[model samples]
Target: MKAQPIHTIRLILIPFTLEITKTLMAGDTSILQQLGLQLTPYWPDQEAIDTFPKIIHNLEKVPEPNGFESYMVVHRHSMTVIGDAGFKGLPNTEGEVDLGYAIITQAQKNGYGLEVAQGLVNWAFQQTNVKAVTARCLLANVASARVLERLGMQQVSSDAELIRWKLPKPVTQATIK
Candidate 1:
């Protein structure tokens, strides 16, 4: 069966040179504090790693990371780096990939995450091989889960603290006839 296009957001291809750009320019880290994500285990060495370097390093190497194709979420209006959304893992044996994202505190509840999530999924589908997209969120993270559902993903199951969601194989273009 042929794959289909199944998402509803516009996507742009940004080079790693942009997101991973490193310079002496002062950067804002307030988004971290605002989102309450600054201390997450994801960034375990908060002190030694340093904020700027961490982001640069993450951007620089994320595409080839063990399980992610990270991209920086930037505001088209203000042009500030807002948050991040990306595919979290390679296509599994079943041909599905995991999706994940986060928004700086101030950026939350404003529809950015939703747009980026949709856009990312749209872009993934354009890769022309992905059968589906899966997202796992903390059970208590209603907001995150809502992003997936609002994009038409359905709750598949849960394990412990994680809520798993799925976007079924897209309706193929051939099927549209």
Candidate 2:
């Protein structure tokens, strides 16, 4: 697959491509590790992710049905795996879409998170007939808020469990190059 270019007002974030598998079988662990990200499906090492079983279960289905997807975001110059960004489902009632992403710790300071995140959002809005994209972030995660804001999503509600933000419609469009 070719690289994709994402544009914001002052910066441009590039994407590596979309990759999905039951496990981190073929990807280079060291390279992904240097990017400050865990190739493991679950955030923290554990027995296993509850969702892992489902992911594996759905592997056989081509063009994954719904609420399932993944992608890698690569930095333009370095060509490094800066982060993993993608949506989980096609879309749900009320047009709510779930999104998840994380940048390697080493690549955190740069705007790659925002750039790639916006790219994901733009892609999602374009691919599906959805009205809005939603994400849940920890209230303390300022970095997450910053990234969401860059993608044109605003905080709409907050609860004890999560900080919710919604992207009504992506005004910025990016295409894979």
Candidate 3:
């Protein structure tokens, strides 16, 4: 299956290829430059860099267009990779898919997180059997919570440390016969 890049007003969510993941895991910069992404300061937060190897492993099991793979959030104007985002995997039997994202320190506060999440959530809903998208953020992450809220996700659960949000598939009106 072909992996199609999801586009937003200012970002392009390109699925991470296995080769790219491996290269990243190995601390290689050539691939980034090869992809025309900015080098040097190009870096996601520690969390994303640490979790990517595991993401690659999981993607190996399910493969693209079916598995839960991460996407490189490319800034359209700068042509630089500003972050990463995507679902945890295919939707569960209940048709719920978990989503996550992180913007680089330099790229934060530019509304990239919201744009990326909105694009991914919309893409997920367009897929077969996807009924809802879910996300959670640390209680300290007010920005992330705001992004979810702006995306129209409802708070379903919360604790001292985290808040969970969900967005159900939008209802479409059918024409009368």
Clashes (candidate 2): 6
Higher-scoring candidate on lDDT, 1 or 2: 1
Best by TM-score: 3
- lDDT string, candidate 3, 55-128, tens digits: 78767876454535689899988888888899887788989999999998888898999999989987887776
Residue 146, candidate 3: C-alpha displacement in angstroms? 0.5
lDDT of 2 by residue, 51-93 (tens): 4443344344434333235455555454444555556655677
Model 1 — TM-score against the truth?
0.65
Model 3: ten consecutive residues of lowest lDDT: 168-177
TM-score of 2: 0.64
Ranked candidates (lDDT, high to low): 3, 1, 2
Candidate 2 residues lying further than 4 Å off, grouped into runs, are: 1-20, 23-68, 170-177
> Residue-wise lDDT of candidate 1 within 1-177, one digit each (tens)?
221222233322232222333431234344434433222332212222244354456445444333235555655554455555566545777878888777777667888778888887776775545778998999999898888889999989998899989997688776365
> Would you list the clashing residue pairs of candidate 3?
none
